[model samples]
Target: MEEEKYIGYIKYEGNLVEDGLMDARKQAQALLGFDSALRHFIGKRAPDFRNLDFEIPVRIRKGSWEALIPETVGGWVQGGLGIVATAYFTKAAQKMAEKDFSDFGITDLFKHAISAIQWFVRIGKHMGDTAIRSFENVQFLEGNTLVAIPNDSGEYLYVPKKMLDLYTSCNPKILEKIAENIEEGRELTIGTIVNGKVEEVAIYAEEKGIFCEEEAEPEEDVLFPELVHGDDVVLEGEVTRENKTSNSMGFKYEEHILTAYPESGSVVRYKPLLFLKCRLYGTVSRLDEKGSIAARRPKLYVSHLEPLESDREEDDLFR
Candidate 1:
């Protein structure tokens, strides 16, 4: 309960805690979301948090439903790296020794990160069709641990590599359980607290885009055997499969089946054409080693997917 050692919290309020009571089962279920979200958040920003052997202890306090992460806990691993406060380490000293972070309290960096995410969540929740700059043009200055992100306005933003991973860390499906906590008659807020101030960003019941709906991590390399190299080929195909969990998909091309993976956010805009015929512009990235090294049973790294304007007549042919 020490304010100086207090790092962060996932505090819930509103209807769920109006009476200062929550069911044991519901509380445990809610902890599932807290577990994943907190670990994922910290693990991305600090790699050592994932490597720690013991579970990070988070004590839930009474009243408004608070799960506080104490920063004073020491974490020991197989390498005898007795790192304490694995989750609350600042970006300035994420990979460095504890002395690097001891100079200042954990308020500034921790507060800024939570505050920034809160700002982003608020913007994402209300963002409709308004266009924003995509990460496609973001060029970074290479680094061992940190990189500098360049904006179109010619300003350089220095960000740690682990922090940069946050951009690709979101999995919308992973949030369904968390979002369910806020029911029709209930209200909730998931936020970080520094010192004692809770963030103002709240996830409402009707919010749709709070969590970015993009493709999660994909597994293609290890799923199959070795894929022989092949030349780039542009082909028209029907997306036979689309997996929200992974970026990989089944593509039907000219009576031949191909494994297709979208580049960037191509699938997001072209979802309407998933089961229909579409023109694909991409390289035949990999070929089946079990078959001829030719384009037979190829795998595609698609950069563009265009739905065919003309036809539903031959749609059954792809089936």
Candidate 2:
């Protein structure tokens, strides 16, 4: 973390950038997506590294109209990777590596950022529920449901978890926000400086459609579509109880424990993930006749289950 060197840079060309100008709104949004992408890249390794700040100094090519983040965006702050920013990021990176995140640092986050974006590009299309076999550094049974990520050096322990959060930046919702300035003639270059050179990922306007969301039907229970959702029907929680014979587990989201009946994939892969945070995707049970008269915790007919980052240790609540 050197004050003289940039950890990463976002370069924009064409349209406004060609004229030595940038739209303030688009700049902010691009930064938001950029910041979000970086956060996701480091989330699994540093789940609680929330308050982070970096000095984004605006730089312009001397003759060409290529614009890095604009000075107006930084706004009167003589911007550069100042001493304060460097020390802060360095100390934080060291702390994370010492505790839960072994061999991970702020620079490694930029490196993974490139990897995540490239992996998304490699998949070509969203796999959705179609089971995916191992594809390089990643393997998944369903969207966000990773099966394994093992490497020779044991480097990929957190990759799948990284991908889970990386989805936040790649989804159509975030794409549109980041691509607001993108048009037929415009181009975006997102890169991370590794060593002395830059590893760039080009984002073309035409290629933006490739990141578009696929069409799919909404999920609803066949028997009970209108049943009141128990506890506002949140599908995320810790596994408080499990019934191995029946392949059912109790999903605890605070005080309420909802009965969760997971599908086959979940049955096979979910037991080891108990006590960790999980997001179960499926339909909540409808309020039946007997339960209609009284309140009860709803049941989750789980179609898929994906574990969150491994940080929280099993404790009294999980037991």
Candidate 3:
């Protein structure tokens, strides 16, 4: 696998109030000053990219403020309020003409950038002169989840395994930490990179000394016309045409033809059952696609094999 790289920028928008005073241009300039400090910090910390230059061009308009990030350093602006931030991938990050760097990984870089800024803010708070305001919206751009789907071309689109790893690992950790450490008068917005864009997933806010938010339920009417890659489905059917093989890596894999009986009709699908420790009569999520001559019949990379309740007999029934 090739190493993926990215160019990250943290855009901060807000006002600087000194002695209950607010000046648009002055606030923008203050942010520009902080940008200088940010550059220095990035130079001292991320020595690997010391050559990267950052431009902090300040823009001021009617109730509109913008600060450009030109260097690699992440720093805090004294008397500045954060509204939003975004990061874009550099040319160096692209691996191939078709393949882009993983969004999950870019989000990781964004978190690191924010942490660097927060560190600077904490230090300034100790000095009692700098006050950093929390951002209402924070996002890392150029983030995406790579998904594969079959088209007319008899080739398979492969979702990189690393993408899945990053999504499953990073999301939960970030959410848990935010939920545990969220302070009073602050809110945290959570989102994921979906199809090359940042999609807001959830928000955590402090209310009545507790973080409470409504959970989003999956849409019931959202059904795919054809089974595509990365579709979560429940397959309750009989296993047929089963086969097993071992790869050069000595990994044993299994595949079987599943015939499912839905209320509308019966559908036949080929799926993989990799080291599943249960009987196959439950829900599974599609992972990858293996194109076939029959466009409708594609091999599926599936996981999360959950056995049906009927398949699990109680102690009395077993006896």
Candidate 4:
């Protein structure tokens, strides 16, 4: 292995107001004897970039907001009453980028500013109480006993091995050995840390202890019928209604369409409340002993169609 060598770069933010104000006060005496237009120009014209010296040299570091100036100026800073102030403030940044490229040979301005601008936005949001809210909710089911706790602040520090061990201790009836049968599943809930970051796992029964199984490749199930026309075939909506003659339970869907099987489920949009126009596929699971639907209504099954020869040939070029 060879050692890598890298060059160091420094970003500068020059202070104009403090230095300019001091110089303006000194230059007022010289401006008094000039013509009215010159006097006004002298009073208003800000000094050039070369002359001003900044009191503070804010260093750009890992968590620094130095990178966010460009984005803010381009996005929110260009509008409203403070436009003049925003323009004046960001001018230094524009000049600084030019100076950086000339002096340090850095060519890409956008890439360099991205990290800084993101940090600045993050800090601004955090300071203004707009930080994103993430909950740490957990539901642990050991045998038959179910324990659910809401973690709003992400402070669930202790997850004992014993908690997992109790799965076999209680020997719940509904518990299945999903790990043994299924190759891969994540048992841990979303947002919870497994080994510093979030991990996936599943819950099932064991002889003496409940255990976590790492993710594994899942076995694919073969669907009947090679190809169907249109994008509806691709969506593969959930099967809600099974093939059945009469529906005793009141289902409040706007329109119900019957399929070959009565107990098959209905396919709605991805979100239940959203009413986007999409197709729903349906199929019926076999009925239970009581003649009631063993599975719920609107059970949609997506039929996977094999591609035509032309489609496959066309895809090869893109791939």
- Which lDDT value does model 3 have at 142? 38
Q: Per-residue CA lDDT of candidate 2, range 242-297, in tens? A: 54345677676644556688644435345556556777677666565776623343
Task: Single out the weakest 10-residue window by summed lDDT for candidate 4.
Answer: 183-192
Better of 2 and 4 by lDDT: 2
Model 4 spans > 4 angstroms off: 1-159, 171-280, 290-319
lDDT of 4 by residue, 119-167 (tens): 2222222221112122235555555344433322233422322322322
In candidate 1, what are the lDDT values of residues 162-193, reduced to their tens digit?
44556445553444455556644455565665
TM-score between model 4 and native: 0.15
Number of the top-ranking candidate, with TM-score as the measure:
1
Between candidates 3 and 4, the one scoring higher on lDDT is 3
Worst 10 residues of 1 by lDDT: 125-134
Taking the tens digit of each residue's C-alpha lDDT, what string does model 3 give over 170-272?
2122223223323333233222232345433222231101221223224333233355534445443333222211110011113323322212211211222
lDDT against the true structure, per candidate, is 0.52, 0.51, 0.30, 0.25
Looking at model 1, residue 241 earns an lDDT score of 52
Ranking by TM-score: 1, 2, 3, 4
How do all models score by TM-score? Answer: 0.43, 0.40, 0.22, 0.15
